[model samples]
Target: MHVKSQRVFTRLTQLKELILESDLFIAEYNLDNIQFVQHAEDLLIPDGKSLSDLIGEKKFRKIHKIIEKSFKVDLRQFEYYLPLLIVNIIGEAILTKDYHLPLDIFLWNFAKESEKELDGVETYASQQQIMQAIKMKDQLKMVKDISKRPYIYRKNILKMAKWYEEESINLLYKNGKKSLGKYKHILLKKRNFIMADRFEELTLNQKSFMAVGAGHLAGQHGILKLLKDKGWKLKAI
Candidate 1:
């Protein structure tokens, strides 16, 4: 076998060993962890930004002009908050005219109705810590690049949504890893391991439902594979 495949086999073997040795039971999972709502509101609902907070007034004006010319958005309205604006763009594209509640919140509400416990893998503080670690320069560059290909923003969203509904794990894994380069470790791997550990501890012998982002269920380091390694039987429903 090639080195990469060999390594994957080794990792899977190791996970099998861990699962065999552990005492936690593996509960069933959904076809895919759907996240119809992008949580863009959480990012944009905070206080407004100022020109100084974004690089500087001069550079901000330049970038804002470029964005306005290309996307026709009033950046000054958001105080040149590129990340939140980009998020809003994607959210708008995906959401379109739909008015349904986000699947995660819907599931949470259902769990509440059933009197089941609700938990998150990490707290809001930890999530913010991860978000704050990304450099501002990278964030700006990302926004600029996406701005140039604005149409692809929605195209990719639709493609992922289709792939997700189809439960195409391999395609989802490939695409999920493509966009998240340096941020992958903090956003995906570390959180997946932490959540897997938490799930093991919390589930024990009880059955539970975990509604995480669809991306979290893909890739070798994803939560599903990680849990599978720990001897959890995951069947699509």
Candidate 2:
């Protein structure tokens, strides 16, 4: 849900239809809730610190160079715009003229929380390893390579979804066989279990439509699999 102008109406219509059919509508975060919005804003920019401050000037400058070179996008146009780019890299919804806030805010907060939690216990060696990984010239080259492929909309949506899901899982759990991996595990896998618990409780008592990021839908520890393992039968619509 990257807020492309062409797909906004289509996505809106689909959401309306789903909402009409369900007694309860659950999203990753309740975008319309003011309290949640405040919380997310605080989490994303804690103590009024910018992304550069949180990541450090040296690391941020290096990352900025990597992204600019790899993606060929100029980030000098605005302050705090790097978060938007980072969000895009992580597959979170992007904010655009056609879309509003809160919807695009939660994931940034979630990502920040993951980093903070990891930072609490990350060893200096592990931190160095993560920084090295991020600073690699080819760190984001794979994304650039993938973007070059021709993809027909709708037809390629499922395939793209599967690819993103697998990549997310691998980054968080499989390839993450280190502290960075643990951070990803907390961000996605652990969060999936928590979300599954709440989703299970809600569905048991009422008809519900739960909308989550596509990345949370598959994988061994994904919400759907967790629910299925708990004896709930699942049927794809």
Candidate 3:
């Protein structure tokens, strides 16, 4: 117990340095104010039950009928995971309407053109593992809830576009954190910590330009704060 307490204390002290110690640093600029445009997507669990098991028998039947008529898909293969299907379909539709090549592709291309070594903080496999950590039932519930919030989805997309235009990192951070809520621990903080540690290591060897999802730039545990804690200087450009 004493040893555990010591470890906890050490972690808390480090966290304090990242969050509260910035007051003493004159060179630290607010990276959260820089608005960057980006995009991200979530992974769906491969395993799911029937639509009736997920939603309800009557509602599932009604929804399945509607979906079949509309999209002509035989839902039996996916009926068990109706929530996941619904959310994914909705997400794709929205993204399609506003779709362009992902910004990261351009960034990657630019880096290649510049003859810079390319690296990623985490691999696609690691990201999948992180996403798989979410409870499947909770994932279903979240998607179902999201499906009911069309206005919120529209609002979020508009907010993202506006933030990108204005370079409002703080507003993007605030909204993204709110949207993730409890899951932010997995989706944002954990990934941010890993990325920050890797970034610190890379910067030690050479100057590097890191482009990541905008959501990873804000909040207490965000990469900017993590870098600042490591004594890296941040300048607003």
- Residue pairs of candidate 3 with colliding backbone atoms: 35-167, 49-80, 50-79, 50-80, 51-79, 51-80
- Each prediction's TM-score versus the true structure: 0.69, 0.51, 0.65
Cα lDDT tens digits, model 2, 41-140, are 4223325556556557776676556545544444333224234334343332221234343333333233333332111111233323433334322333
Tens digit of per-residue lDDT, candidate 1, span 1-237: 101112113234433343344433222222123242234344442455554475677776776776676557656766534473454454343433332444444444445555555566656556666666776667666665656675676577667666655668668667768877878888778888988998888777765556566677877898889999999898864
Model 1, position 235: C-alpha lDDT score: 80
Candidate 3 segments whose C-alpha is farther than 4 A from its true place: 1-44, 47-53, 56-89, 95-100
Which pairs clash in the backbone of model 1?
none
Candidate 1 segments exceeding 4 Å error: 1-77, 80-85
Candidate 3: tens digits of C-alpha lDDT, residues 1-237: 011112113233333333232212111111221232111223323453455676678866665565455444445555544353455454434432321323444334444554556666766556656666767676666554544555576566655655755667778778878877778788888888988887776556555566577778877888899889989889864
Off by over 4 Å in 2: 1-15, 34-86, 89-182
RMSD of each: 10.5, 10.5, 13.6
Model 3: worst 10 consecutive residues (lDDT sum): 1-10
Q: What's model 3's overall lDDT?
A: 0.55
Each model's lDDT = 0.58, 0.46, 0.55
Which model, 1 or 2, shows the larger TM-score?
1
- The TM-score ranking, best first, is 1, 3, 2
